[model samples]
Every structure is written in C-alpha cells, then in structure tokens.
Target: MTTGIVLIILSAALLHATWNTIVKTAGDRTSTLGLVALGHVIPGLVMVTVLPFPSVESWPYLIASTVIHFGYFYMLGQAYKHGDLSVVYPIARGIVPALVSLWAMLFVGEILPAQAWYGIALIAVAIQISSWAALRHGVGRAALFFALGTGFCISGYSLVDGVGVRLSGDTLSYWAWHSVLHIFIVGFIALRRGNAIRALPRRTWMIGILGGIVSMTAYGLVLYAKNFAPLGAVSALRETSVIFAALIGFVFLGEGNWRRRLLAAVLMAGGVALIGLSI
Candidate 1:
C-alpha cells in the first residue's frame, strides 16, 4: 500500500476507536447504537440522493454486508454490556486480520506476501497482549462469546466490502448505499426498544449520532483504501485500532493496565511498520 493509503487506513482506525469509545461510555448502549446507525442513515439518505447508485453487480455483496452488520452491532453492544471497552474492543477486533486474510485467500483468491502474513501474525499477537489482563482474570464467558461473534461479523463485512467496492465502479456510491441500508439495523433496534429509545436524553442522542458520523467516516476511509491495497494488509493495519482502543480506555474510560497496553502498542507499531514496508 502507498503512504497515502496507509495514512488513510490509520485515520480510519483512530475514528473507529473513537466511536467505539463513545458507545462504551454511553448509559444506554442499545439506544446509543441505534442512534449510531441513524448517524449512518442521515448522511446516507442525502448521499444516495445525490451520488450515483452502486453497480447492479455489487448489490448482493452490499445486501450481505448490511446483514452482517446487524450481527456486528448486536454483538458489540452485548460485549460492551458484559465487559470493559479495553477488554471487549481488543477481543472483538483482534481476530479480524487473520480471518479476513484467510477468507480473502480462500474465497477471493487474494494472496498476501509472506512478510505481510508475518506482520498480520504480529498484530494478532499484539491484540491478544493488549487484552492479557482481562484474559487472565477472565472477562466473563458472555463477553468472550459476544466479542468473538463481533470479530466474525467484522471479518465477514471486511472481505465482502473489499471485493464489493472493487466491483462497484465508484467507492463513494457503494459506501453511500451501504450506509443508507443501515436503516434496517436502526429500525430493528427501534422496534425492539421503542419506548427506551424514545426516552433517551437529547444529549445521548446527539453524542450517539455524532459517534455514528465518525463511524461512517471511518468505514468510508477503509473502503476507499481497499480499492488500492491488498485485503489482508489493509485489515492487519486496520486492526491497529485495538491499540488505539486500549489507549482510549486507559486515558478516557480509566480501564486496563497502561503499562501492558503500552507494550502492546509498541509491538503493534512494529507490525504496522512491517506491513507498510512490505507493501
């Protein structure tokens, strides 16, 4: 990947961590999650109106991606409810790089360089290290299960969008449609918890929507970079968000051991450097 693409993906990583932090801090996670989905929907509605529709060929992947996101959002909310952001975020994002690499190789026929694979392995290790304390002490079976489920959903959507964006002819249009389709996720949450959602404070709504905007921007950046880079490399680099999440949890949420998190960050940075150099 080029320097520009690396920087773009890194920026996305930061934004990704930021939004997750927003969700982690929220009092009503499910309602905040719905607002986050609405965040995507609001911009998506305007963008779809103005942007060209994604190609017909990409529709299947688009729909599939939206479906996967439902599981992702659900698992993420559940995981947060059961564990700290520091614990849940790392586990949830930790497994995605390898899973996306494997899926890309098996299904998409995308082979990454050996060095990139090593970098990916290093990142995977770093992710686990970031969560070592939680792992040792136990983050609860429910948290572990939900976090793993979230990781699976993330990998699924990553591969689908990586190929889908390439075929869509226009990355922004594909993203716009994908964002608009988040309406289903938002609607589902609303239907199940309409009374609760309706009762959330205005401040909560604003923060959640803002978080959604950040999340949408992060997704757009990753999709744009996917158009230019290998899936495995992009994903390995993107999973650096776990490091960012660790820092956020420590600094903002007052969670986790900062010393261990620092070590993980250094290791992840080395992995990132390897991936950047290999590409």
Candidate 2:
C-alpha cells in the first residue's frame, strides 16, 4: 500500500473505533445501533438519487452483504450489551484481519508477502494481548461467545465488500446500496421493540445517527483502500481500531487497566508500521 492508502485506512480505523465507542456507551445498545443504521440510510437515500444503479453482476454480492450486515449489527449490539468496549471490541476486531486475509487468499487470490503476513500476525497478537486482563479475569461465557460472533460477522462483511466494490464499477454506489439495507435491519429491530423507539431520548437518537454516519464513512474509506491495496493488508490495518477502542474505553468510558492497553497499543503501532513499510 502507498502512504496515501495507509493514511486513509488508518483514518477509517480511528473513525470505526469512535463509532463503536459510541455504541458501547449507548443507553440501549440495540436501539442505538438501530439509529446508527438509520444514519446509513439517510446518506444512502441521497446517493441513490444521484448515483447510477449497480450492475447486475454486483447484485449478488450486494444482497449477500446486506444479509450479512444485518447479522453483523445484531451480533455487535448483543456483544456490547454483554461486555465492555475494551474487552469485546479487541476480540471482535482482533480476529477479523486474519480471517479476512485467509478468505482473500483462498477465494480472491490476493497473496501477501511473508513480511506482510508477519505484520498481520503481530497485530493480531497485540490485540489479543490488549484483552488479556479481561480474559484472565474471565469476561463471562456469554460475552465471549457474542464477541466471537461479532468478529465472524465482521469477517463476513469484509470479504463481501472487498469484492462487491470492485464489481460495482462505482465504489460510492456499492457503498450506498449496501448501506441503505440498514433501514430494513434497523426497522426490524425497532418493530420488535414496539413504541420504544418513540420513547428513546433525543440525545440517544442524535448520537446513534451521528455514530452511524461515522461508521459508514469509516467503512467507505476502507472499501476505497481495498481498491488500491491488498485486501488482507487493508483489513489488518483497519483492525487497529481495536487499539483506538481500547483508549476510548479507558479515557471516556472509565475502564481500567490502561497501562496494559496502552502498552499493547504501542506494539500494535509497531505492527502497523511494519505492514505499511512492507507495503
């Protein structure tokens, strides 16, 4: 990856972490995630008006991605409900790069050199290290499973979008259509909650919507990066969001074990540097 691509992916990583932090701190994770999904819908609506429709070839990936994204959001909301940002976020984000990398090589044939592979391994290890305190103390069986589920959802979408954008011939169009599906997913959740959507506070609504915007932009950047860089490298770099999420958990959410998390963040930074240099 070029320096420009690295910077873009890193910016996306930060934004991704920011939005997840927002979700983790929300009053009701499910509802907040719904609002976040709504955030994707508004921009998607605008894009649909101006952008050309995606090609027939892209539709399969788009449809599959939409279904996968619904599951992703569900798993994420549940994970945050049952675990802290620092604990769940690292595991969830940590596992994705390796899975995405493996999928890319086996299915997409995007090969990475040994150096890049080393960087990916380093990043994954650092992320697991960051979660050591929680793991050592026991994060509860429920939270562990939910977090793992969230990671699986992330890996699913990463691979789907990696190919989906390239096929669409218009990156923005693919992103818009993929995001618009959020409406159905969020609407389904809202429906199940009855009139609770109306009862949600204005602040919660605002945060969710804004966080959704950030989340969309973050992934949009990643999709663009994938066009320029290897999918595995891009995915691994994006997982740096776990470190950012850890800091957000520490500084904002009042989570503990900052010393360990920060140390892990430093190691993760080195791993990212290696990935960038190797690229």
Candidate 3:
C-alpha cells in the first residue's frame, strides 16, 4: 500500500476508536446510537444531492448491507452495556479481520499470505489476553457473547459493503446511500425505545452527532481504501482501533488491569503492522 493509503486507514482507525469510546461512555447506548445515526444521515443527505445514483444492481447489496449494519449497531450497544470499553472493544474489533478474511476467501476468492494468517492469530490471541484478568475475577458470559456477536455483525457488514461499493461504481454514492439507509433502522430502534428521542439532553445529542459524523467518516475512509487495497489487509489494518480503544479506555473510561491490556495492545499493534506490511 502507498503511504497515502496507510495514512488514510490509520486516521480512520483513530476516528473509529474515538466514536466507539463515545458510545461506550454514553448513558443510553441505544438513544446515543440513534443520534449518531441522524448525524450519519446529514452528510449522506448532502452527498445524495451532489453524487450520481448507485446502479440498480447495487440496491440489493445496499439493502442487505443496511440490515447487517443495523444488527451491528444493536449488538454493539448491547455489548457496551455489559462490558468495559477495553474488553468489549478489543473482542468486538479484534475478531473482525479473521472473519472478514474468511468471508472474502469464500465469496470473493481473495487469499492472504501465510504471514497474514499468523498476524490474524496474534490479534485473536491478544483479544483473548485482554479478558484474562476479567476471567480470573469472573467476567460475565453475557458480555463475552455480546461482544462476539458484535464482531460477527461487523464481519457480515464488512463483506457486504466491500462487494456493494465495488459494484456501485461510485464509492461516494455507495457510502452516502449506506449512511442514509442507517436512518430508518435507527428510527425503528428509537421507536421501540418509547419516547427515547425526547429524553436525550442537548449535550448527549451533540456528542452522539459528533460520534456519528466520525463513524461515517472513519468507514468512508476504509471504503475508499478498499477500492485500492485488498479487503482482508484493509480490515486488519482498521482493527488497529482495538489498540487505540485500549488507550482511550484507560485514559477516559478509567478501566482497570491496564498492565495486561497494554500488553495485548502491543501484540495487536504488532499483528496490525505485520498485516499491513504483508499487503
């Protein structure tokens, strides 16, 4: 990958970690996510006016992606509800590269080198290490499963959007439409929460919106990077957000057991570097 692509992906990683931190810290995960979804739609609404429409063939993929993304957001909110950012975020983000690699191989026939596989293993092990202390102290099974579900949802949507955007023939159009589609799903969620929208304070709305914008921009960068890089490599590189999340958790969320979590972060960073270099 070029230096430019590396920079873009790294920048996206930071932004992705930042917004996830916001989500983990929010008082109401579902409502905050709704606000973020609204934020996502604002930019998409603007881009829709300027960009060409996605091809008809891309609509099916777009619809499928939208459903999968909704699952991702819902599961993520549930995960954060039961777990700290350091643990949940690492598990949720760490497993993505392996899952995405498997999906890409089965659906798109993209294969990574052996080194990349080793890197994936390292990342997975790092994620396991992240929870070691919690396990000794009796972590809840619910949080583990929820985080795993979140990871699965991430892999599902990553594969869907990878092919969806490629088929759309316009990255910006595909991205914009994807963001716009998030609105309906979030709306349904808000409705289900019963008057949740009215309960959000001004400050929460601002934070949620900012998080939404950052989330949109972060993945937009990844989609753009995917156009130029291998999907697995790009996904692995982005999972570096796991490490960024660890630091954010320690500093911002006041999470404990940082000694081991920091070690896991170092391993994850090494794995990310190996994956990026393999590309």
- The prediction achieving the highest TM-score against the true structure is 1
Expressed as tens digits, the lDDT of each residue in 83-170 for candidate 2 is 8666787788888898998999999998888888889988898887877877677787778899999899889888988898888899
In model 2, how large is the Cα lDDT of residue 210? 97
Off by over 4 Å in 1: 78-85
- lDDT scores for all predictions? 0.90, 0.86, 0.83
lDDT by residue for model 1 (1-279), tens: 788999999999999989988987888888888999999999989998888888999999999999898889889878877887667877878889999999999998999888888899899999989889877777899999998999999999999999999999999999999999999998999999899999999988899999999999999999999998889889989889888988888988788788999999989988988888887
Residue-level lDDT tens digits of model 3 in 133-186: 654554478888888999999998888888888889999999999999988877
Worst 10 residues of 2 by lDDT: 77-86
Angstrom error at residue 199, model 3: 1.9
| TM-score head-to-head 1 vs 3, winner | 1
The TM-score measured for candidate 2 stands at 0.94
Best by lDDT: 1
lDDT of 1 at 56: 94
**Residue-level error in angstroms, candidate 1, position 8:** 0.4
